[model samples]
Target: MDVRSDTALRLPASDVSPWVGLIGLATLLSYILFARSFPEISAALGFENDLGRLSGPYSALLAMVLTGGAMAAWSVCVEKVHRNPSTGIDWDRRRPVADVLNDSITKLAGLWATWFIIAGLYCLGRWYWDGAYLFAMQVMGAAVVPLVLLSVPYVIWIDRVMDDPRDQSWHFGAMLIGRENFDVELVKKHWRAWIIKGFFSAFMISILPSGFAAVVDSDVTEIVRDPVRLGVLLFELLFVIDVQIGTVGYLLTFRPLDAHIRSGNPFLAGWLAALVCYPPLAWGVLGNILQYEVNTADWAYWLADYPALLWLWAGWLVFLTAIYAWATVAFGIRFSNLTYRGVLTNGPYRFTRHPAYVAKNLFWWGSVLPFLVTNGSMVDMIRNTAFLALVSGIYYWRARTEEAHLLLEDEKYREYWDWMQENGAITSRIARLLDRMNPRKGMSGAVQPAE
Candidate 1:
C-alpha cells in the first residue's frame, strides 16, 4: 500500500507526544493546585471572597484557554512528525515578531475602522430611543459583531497562507473552500445537491438538542444556575470536545477501500452543523422557559436582552454553517470523484448547485428572527442584515477564487459543469431567489441547466 494509505489505515499511537503529555499534565496540576486554594485565589482577586462562586467561572475560562493551547500544540506536533525526517521542517528564521505584530495590527485596525462606521449608524438610531437596553445592544452590535465577523475571514486567510506545505492535500483544500480548483461551473453543478444533503444532515443532527430541550422542563438559565444543570452543561461541553478530537483522529487514520469516496465524518460537516444550530436552539428553548417562569412584565426585558445575545449567536451560526456547508459540498465533489451519489437530487440541489450555502443563510436568519421580531428595533435588524450581507459577499468572493482554482485543477469539474448546463440542472428561479436572499451580494446571476 502507498505510504499515505498505510498511514491512514494504521491506528494513531495511543501515546501522545511528550510535549502534549507534559502540557496535559501541567494543566491538570495547575487546576488541581488552583482548586485546592480557590478561597485564597478568590480573596486575592476580590471576587466575593467565596471560592465556589469564583471557582466555576475562573476554572472554566482557564480550562478553555489551556485546552485551546494544547490543541494548537498538538496540531504543531502532528505536523512536525508527519514531515520528512531527513531535512526536517524548515523554519522561517528571518521572519521577525515585529512583522507579525504589524500584520496583526493592520488587520485589527481595519476591522475596528469598519466597526466604528457601523457604530455611527447605530448611534443615529439610538438618538431617538436612547436607553440602557438600546445602549447595551448598540455596544454589542458595534463591538462584538464586527470583531467576530472580521475574525472569520481573517482566520480563513491566515490558514491558507500559513498552512504547512506537507499537510496540503486535495481534501484539505476542498474542506477549506467549495472546490479545490474553485470552479464556479462545477460548484454551480453540485451546489444544490449538496445543500439538500446538508439540510437533511443538519435536520437530523439538530435532534439531540431538540430532544434535550423536550425532556428538560426547567429553564436553561435556572438549570445552568443550579449545580446539577451546570454539571450537565459541563459534561455536554466535554462530550463535544471529545467527539471533535476523536473525529480528527479517525479522519487521520481511517482509509476506506475507495480513496475517491469521502466518509461522512460527523465531526467535519455534520458535527459542525449541529454545533452551529444547537446552542441557539438551546438558548431559544431556554429563553422560552425563562419567559414562562418569569412574570409577564419582565418578559419583554428577557426577550430583548436574550435576543441580542441570539443575534450574535446567529451571526456565528451563519458564518460557521456557510463554511461547513461549502466544505462539505466541495469535499464530496472533489474527493469523492463520484459522478452521482444516487440520483434523487431533486430537493436542495434542484434549486441551485450549492444548497449548503443556502441553508447556512437560512440558519443565520432563523437564529436572528427572534431578536429582530422581539426587539422591533430597525437598527438591530439593519445592523445584523448588513453584517450578514458582508459575510455573504466575502464568501462569494472566496467561492469565485476557489472556482478559478478548481477549473485549473480538476478537469472532471468541467464535464460536470457541462452536464449540469446541458441537463437544465444548473440554476432555478427559486435558487436565484435564495441566492438573492443570501447576505452575500453580486453572486453569479446565470444558472446552467444540468445536462
Candidate 2:
C-alpha cells in the first residue's frame, strides 16, 4: 500500500474521539459542581460567610464550577479545531487565547497558594501564642490591604505603560507560561542577574531590625505604638516602593544585555557570589539598624507624625523621582535605537549619564541620616557609614562596568563620554574616593568617571 493509504488505514475513526470529549465534559461538570458548593463547605469549616445572603456560598460555588467547565469546554474546542489538518487551528490565531488563558491560570494558582500558606502560618502562630495570633492577623491584614490597593494598580499601570505590544512574547508571563520559542541560555543569564540584584536590594531594605520584627517575629502590634519607630516603619515602606519600582525598570531595560552574556555556569557563580556577599553586607558590615516591636495602632501613630517627617520624605521623594526619570530617559534612548521609537530625554540624563544610580545612593543616604542624627548612637553611626561606603563602592564599580560594555558596543557612547569629560559634566570624585579607600582593585580598573 502507498504511504497515504497506510496512514489512513491505521487512523482512529471520529467515533473514538467522543471518549476524549466525554472525559473533558465530565471534568468540567465535576469542577462546576464542587465550586458551586464550596462556600457552604467553607462556612461549615469555620470560614467567614461574607459572600452575602441570597447569593452566598452556594452562588460562589456555582460560579467556580461554571468557570472550570467553561475552561474545559474551551480546551475541547481548541482540540477539535486542531483535529482537521488542512483547515485546522493556525499558530498565530490560536496562540494569543492560549497564552492569555495560561497566564491567568498560572497567576491565579500562585496567588491562591500564597494566600493559603499565609493563612496557614497565621493559624499556626495563633495556636502557639495566646491572643498574639489574633492581634498579628489584624495588624497584618491592615498593612497588607492598603499596600496592595496602592501598589498593585501602580504596578499594573507601570507594566502597561512600559509594555511594547509588538514584543508581548518577551513578557514574563508569556516566557514562563506560554509555548514560545524561548532562549534557554538567555533566560538563565537574566535570571541570574535578576536574582543578584533582587537579593542585594531585599537585604538592604529588609535586614533592618524593624523588618525582623514585622516579618519573622510577626510582632506588628508593638511596632505601631512608638512615634519614632512608627516613623521609621513608614520610611521603610516607602523605601520598598522605591526599590521595587527601580528594580523592575532595571530588569526590563537590561534583560537583553544580561541575556547576551550567558554561560553554562551562570547560576552557580552568581548564586554563590550573592550568598557570600549579602549577609555581611546587610547585617554585620552595615550601620544603623532600626529596631521595633509590633504594637497596635503603629501605622495610625506613624501617619499622625507625617508632618515632621514630610520634609525629609520630600527630599527623598525628589531624589527617587530624579532617579526614575533618569532611568526612563536613558533607557528610552537606548531602546529607541533598537526600534527607532522615540521618547523624551531632555531632563535628568541631559545632565548626568548615570543620574539614577547617583540619585538612588543619595536617597539611601537621606533615609539613613534621620536615624543617625536623631538616635545619635555611635554604633548606628558607624553602621550607617559602612553601608554608605559599601553601596557607593558597588555603584561605582557597576557604572564603570556598564560604561566599558557601552564603549565596546557603541562608538557614539565614546563621544558622549568625551563630551561629558571635556564639559566637566561627569564627577569622578566619588569613584576616586572609593578607589582610595579600597586596598583591592575593583572588577573594573578605573572609574569611567561619572559622566
Candidate 3:
C-alpha cells in the first residue's frame, strides 16, 4: 500500500503528535499574553472595572479557541487517512462502530489534554489580571469543561459520518486546515443540541446586558420631552427584540449542512481575518492594529446641531436592525457565520445576495454621519475611513469564501450563481454596468433570458 493509504489504515500516535504540543503551548502563551493585557483591553473597549459584563462572552470566546484548536488537531490526524482515497472506510462499509468510537476517544483524549492545559493557563491569566479566582473558576468550570465535553461528540460524529475520502472532496480545503467534517443531515437533526454551542451562546451572553442597560437608561414615563431620545430608546428595545427573534429563528431552522459543501477553517488566514471583525477577539491586540473608531466627535456634536436628523439616524438604526433580523429569519435555522447552510433565494436574499451584510455596513456608515461632520484631524478621518474599508473588505472576503466553499461542494450553488448573474436585482444591475464599461464584442448578440 502507498504511504498515504498506509497512514489511513494505521492509527495516529496521539502522544507523539507534534501539533498537539504546539497548540497547547500556543494556547498557553496566547492566554498569558491576552491576560497580561486584559486590563488594557477592557480600558480600550471602555469597560475598565466593569469587566464583569464581559466575563461571560470572554469565557465563551476562550473556550471556542480552545475547542477549535483541539478539533484542528483531530482534523490533522484524520486528514492523512483521507489523502487520495475513493472513500476511506465510513460506516457504509460496515466498519466496526467500536473501532471508530475508540479512534474518536483517542483523538478526544489528546485534544482534551491541550484544552485542559489552556484552561489552566486561562484561569491563571484571569487571576493574574484581576486578583480574583471566582471568574477564573467560572471560566474553567463553565466554559472549558463544557467545551471539552461537547468536543467529545463533535469529534466522534465528524469521524463517524464524514470519513468518506472522495477526491476533490467538499471538505478537502477545510480538512487541510483541520475543520470539522461537513454533514448536513447529521447537523440538521442534531442542531438543537448545538444551538448553544455556536453563535446563540455568544448572542445570549452579550445581548442581555445591553437590553438591561437600555431599560436602565430609559424613562418611559416622560417620553414627550425628548422624542429623539425616546426614539433611540425604542429602537434599542426593538433592536434587542429583533436580535432575539432572529437568533431563535436561526436555532430553530438550523439546517447547517443542507447545502454545506465545506467551510473555512479556524486555522486558515481567512478565518483569522474574518474573526477580527467581532468583539473579545477584535477588542484585543489584533484589533488594536486594524481597528479605528470613527470620528464620532462629529456625530456627538452634530446630533445636537441637527436635532431633526437624530430621527433619521434612529430610523436608520431601526431599519438596519429590522432588515438584519429579517435576513436571519429568512435563513431560519441556517443562519451562521462562515458556513454554507443552503442557498436562500427568497425573502431578502431574492433582492440581493448579501442583504444582511450590505444593510449592516450601510447602517454603520450612515449612523456615523454625526461623527463624519466633526472637526477631527484629516489624518484621523482617513485612518477611520481606511479601517472601516478594511472591515468591509473582511466581510467581502467572508462572502466570497463562503461562496467558494458552496460552489465547490454543490452544483446547485453554481446554478444559483448563474441565475443570480442574469436576474438578481443588484447583480444584474452591476453586470449591465460592467458590460457597458467593457463593451465585450459579440456578448450583446446573445439572447437574454427573461426573468
Positional deviation of residue 430's Cα in model 1 after best superposition, in angstroms: 7.1
Q: Write the per-residue lDDT of candidate 3 for residues 1-451, one digit (tens) a residue.
A: 1122332333222211233223433443354345445567788888746443323334434433453344344424643422322223343444455756755654565445444544555445433234233433444466666776687666655566555422122233233335565444433322322322243334333443344345334556787456466656655654543443333323332111222223332224445655666544666733687555644543334576677776666666768766765665454323456554445666666656777788878766665642262555777778777777777787778777656666775555666666665677887687667656654424544433445
Q: lDDT tens digits, residues 1-451, model 1? A: 1122333333222212334333443453365345546677787888775434223322433443453355445535653432322222233333344444434444344334444554464456433234323323432444466656766454334333332221222223343334334334433333333332323322222222322222222235665544434434433433323222222221222111011112222123333333333333434532342222221222223334575553444345545454333323222211111112212122334334455555555554444442343446666556555555554554454434434433444444443333333342435354446656756443344332345
lDDT values for all models: 0.37, 0.39, 0.49
Model 1 ranges off by over 4 Å: 1-250, 253-351, 370-376, 421-451
Regarding lDDT, does 1 or 2 come out ahead? 2
Better of 2 and 3 by lDDT: 3
lDDT of 3 at 425: 84
What does candidate 1 score in Cα RMSD to the true structure? 17.8
In terms of lDDT, model 3 sits at 0.49
| Per-prediction CA RMSD (Å) | 17.8, 20.0, 15.6
Q: Identify the candidate with maximal TM-score.
A: 3
TM-score winner, 1 or 3 = 3
Best by lDDT: 3
- How does residue 142 of candidate 3 score in lDDT? 69
The regions of model 2 sitting more than 4 angstroms off are: 1-313, 320-347, 370-387, 424-451
